[model samples]
Target: METDNKESIIDYQYKALKDGKSIRLLYLHTSSSYHQLPIEVSLCEFPIDACPSFGALSYAWSIDDDPAPSDRELLCDGASIKITKNCEAALKRLRRPKQDQILWVDAVCINQADLEERSLQVRLMRQIYTQASWVALWVGDASTAVDEESGLPLSDLGMDFIHDFAVEIAERTNSGQALNEGPLYQEFIKDRRAFQYSESEVFAPRVRGVWDVFHRNWWKRLWVIQEVALATDPTLLCGLKAETFHNLKIVIKALIRSEQPVDVMEFNSLFIAHTFHQFHVRHMIETGTMGKISPPGIKALDILNATRNTQASDPRDKIYGILGFFGPPATDTENIFPDPDYTKPAAELYADVSRAIILNTKNLDVLSSCYGFFKSTVPDLPSWVASWNDTPVQYFDGKIFNAAGSSTVVYEDCGDKLLMRIKGRHVDSVKLAGQIPDSIGYSNEACIELWRYWWKFASTLDSYPTGETVTDVFKDTLCWGSHLDYSRQQLGENKESFNAWLEILTGTDDTDIAAKRIFNDGEPFKYAHRATSVTWGRNMSITNKGYLAMVPIITKADDKIVIFQGSKLPFIVRTEDGTSKLGGPCYVRGMMDGEFATEEDAGAMDELEWFTLK
Candidate 1:
């Protein structure tokens, strides 16, 4: 009987969801030890809006490219199935020892093999999670290694430090010892008497714990942004220990406010998590509105851009996962695409999303976000489509430029879904392109050498087309015509800062001396980093019309610069096969602000030239 049962090969089959609003919940049986007990669960269906009290699991499906083996078998009802090591770990940790634990685990609840069912289930995720009693954010296992110096678990030390840091902040704020709450003005908290740890003291283990906590795989997942944001209450689970999401958020906010020692956007998972918590969730909860007044409301394009650097198992989830934040597409007019259709290819879905955003926003500002034109992984993706896969080197301010004036996108679809046609005015063609530095923000000498090379190249031009001195145009072009401060004002009156930074970079004999000086004087390095960062993945190019401009790294001499009807900035387009392929967006000195298209000509749609993008 045992041999017959073993050879039976029982397979778990999912019954179709009763309706569009229906979802599955798993009842995980109790276990004393994960190693000793077989993981068993039973699935039941219910309407999401009226489902029984259950905790939702929000976790990373796979931690890395070569994830641990999925050799563990899960018993569901009378059948056995395979589950990812990460998912299995989460379930094992989540299972209660006393009684059955009900959960809405996506991997177990949803029938992933069925594409139609997957799409429907994805659409209902917002409801599923929002209605759940609590959200368990499983951030993998806690480190068991004890810090020899501190005599504490490495991961626990990190959480304790964060809690203590928050306590210090509250005590200081209440006592009126407020510090400047900005990344630039990070004055150290000298009052370490409470924590009894000094900046110079032997507290390396504590710092390591802080880094480990923030750099978890769970924080970087794309779906967690919505999962945690929409959850009524969220509990961050790491192996046996747990903490509230609110506390974790306080830690992140405190770091941003007065404690970040490094680039939070680079080292810490700042933008996606912070933006979702402080901006998206806060606005909705405070105002009872879907959008915000100061930073604008939740828009599809904005959401996509915010989470572009986040990871997803399916390329399509890059868009689908974010849809739950706003209203449903069938009802909300602002929603870009229809329901999440897994049947569509990723390239096709991305292209369609691009078109929908352009049409919905009535502007080609989305085109400026298209970094995928050159390096997209999606095969046969349209040049006009933004892949939303990776973050752009620098984000162009949507309100800064209006090369095409106050005009809306004039889209002309020629019955072919893949082909996109738009109208634009020919601005200029590239004449001479200067090489961008191979290494930026690393070596002071390399940046100085490259800047000097650029200055020498600028000297070759007889005169500036914008009527400004070549010196001024060249300086402004390096930072893309805007001041690099928090205000982001135009670079017209900030020449002294640029000159002062350059003097420090060039006036020194040793690069080490320059580096030390810049480090000592923070303002100078701020200017230098901003200048180099914007021009890192780009080059300075002299236009055929004798304009100093910034173009893509792939740009060459004779590449056409064109301003689309609704584009805030001009784009570099390379003509091939009688069609245009976008080289990427550019900054043409003197042509950024409605200089190419006058108000009168821009309004006259018939006067513009139309080009098709393949």
Candidate 2:
């Protein structure tokens, strides 16, 4: 009788595999023991075209470095297999007390030890998560104790505050009321009053609590991007508490619209929140939630850019993990996106993916993400292929933020090897590079030192005529060829526009007082700090032809600033021997927004040369 029962269970499980409609679902049986539990794994076979209702588990693998062996026994077909402690915990928490619970967990469902099986299942990951009833995002056990950094408790109370804040803001947003006049603001004001007894004492802890949750390692996982984005309904599970992705998104949107002043900690939390919201928006567009009229699909390059910092166990998954979101409708004959292959090496895979995106998109924007010697930490890869494993350079999102105008160019794939040929203007070379000034300090002396460097550099620029004094040249350098003034020009004449520009650059309309304090007396120029503090990508460099230009902060003295035809901003290139290295995107003051592609500039392109990036 015992042998018959075992064989019967095996036959039932094997039937699903035979039909090629098999998926292993963990059936957690209720246990009276609080800590020890048994999980029954049953192979369920649905029709090949149809899937049954099951919640997919999206979670980080472990909390520590040591890979703990599967300690708990999971019964499958009357046989037992070991399961990890984390998995056991998840199953126990997710399981119902009286009824059996079925879940599709990657660790157990897929044969991870087999490479071919891993690759095949990864290809099916999109379908697995999408077809599931819902996705449970396990963010680990919740902590009510205060976080050391944010000084806020990681408990249900904090989640409640965030949810309430989101609810109030959503109501107002739906009603189309301005964010300032909305109930969100009113609630904020009330909180501020209640906490006024200790300005730093009260809000700091709460802000920190939000910060702690936002910075959770779960957000950094590459696979979670698709798991959450593709889910029909996703729930964030932190310990015993739960929150919907929809509510979190609402709170994120409200926080983005808020103009309230916050300390660095609050700002960091808000930045992460904004990034998450942006990811969701992009995910929606890619998944066709934005409708058919939206762009046919998202490029692999864009997906990579958005999720560059997302962590993965295998470095190759950095590219493979997000590949499912690319390409056309499932029914389309030709799939432009490269299929995930775990066998490929990280560098080679990244290079091939880069080539594929450029070939399919027919745009050189991918090249803009390639970093130069100074910018790139990866030395082995060729200069042309972007370091997919590296964190994306700050402020260069591959957008044409500062291009004078647009142009088209041809891309030559140069066979299967990682080499490409492009034709564009070489422009000018870098002669002198200065260290990016230190953070604008609170003391007056720091401002004076910064102003002195600016004065020396501005004096070299052709934009500042010879007759003008150092002071005059400094002002001209700030105002001349500024895109910020273009909108102000519609309101008034040149003099009015100049004053507006002066006010912006100096942070005050009283330019004379600001200038005198800096140039004449060498005192602390209150507005001088704005130059360094206001924006990123403002490292000062002198061109070989004696032009002072603002290049990417990673700019070196020998780096070449080249303006590729289709690119919006000038690029910093580092040349070693005969080959060239792209140092990523850059912002050169006057060359932004197609200014470089103006009629006169276009005509000057007759001297275009062949530039080979290795």
Off by over 4 Å in 2: 1-22, 38-40, 43-48, 63-86, 144-153, 170-208, 258-279, 286-298, 327-335, 374-379, 396-405, 436-455, 460-538, 552-554, 593-606
**What lDDT does the true structure give each of the candidates?**
0.72, 0.58
TM-score of 2: 0.74
RMSD of each: 4.8, 7.5
Q: What is the TM-score of each candidate against the true structure?
A: 0.88, 0.74
Q: Ten consecutive residues with minimal summed lDDT in candidate 1?
A: 182-191
Candidate 1: Cα lDDT at 283: 37
Candidate 1 residue-wise lDDT, 358-465, digit = tens? 877778877886653467767677888888766666644656777888887788888877878998878789999997655465456566666667777877888987
Clashes of 2: 12
Tens-place lDDT per residue, model 2, 1-614, is 01123232221222224333445566656654445445555656444246656789987666443445765556676766556766666776687757766678887776666676576667667677778888898766666566576654555545666677677777777888666565534443434433423432354445445545665567777788888877877887766777887787776656544355433224434346524733564456656654332222234555677777777777788777875564333753224445667777666776777666665554567766576544444445777687767765443234525362556544555564656566566667788876655564424444334445555666556552234344443443333223221221111223433443344344542444444444321223222323333234445667776556655566788787777765656778876776676776664444555655533255565756556677
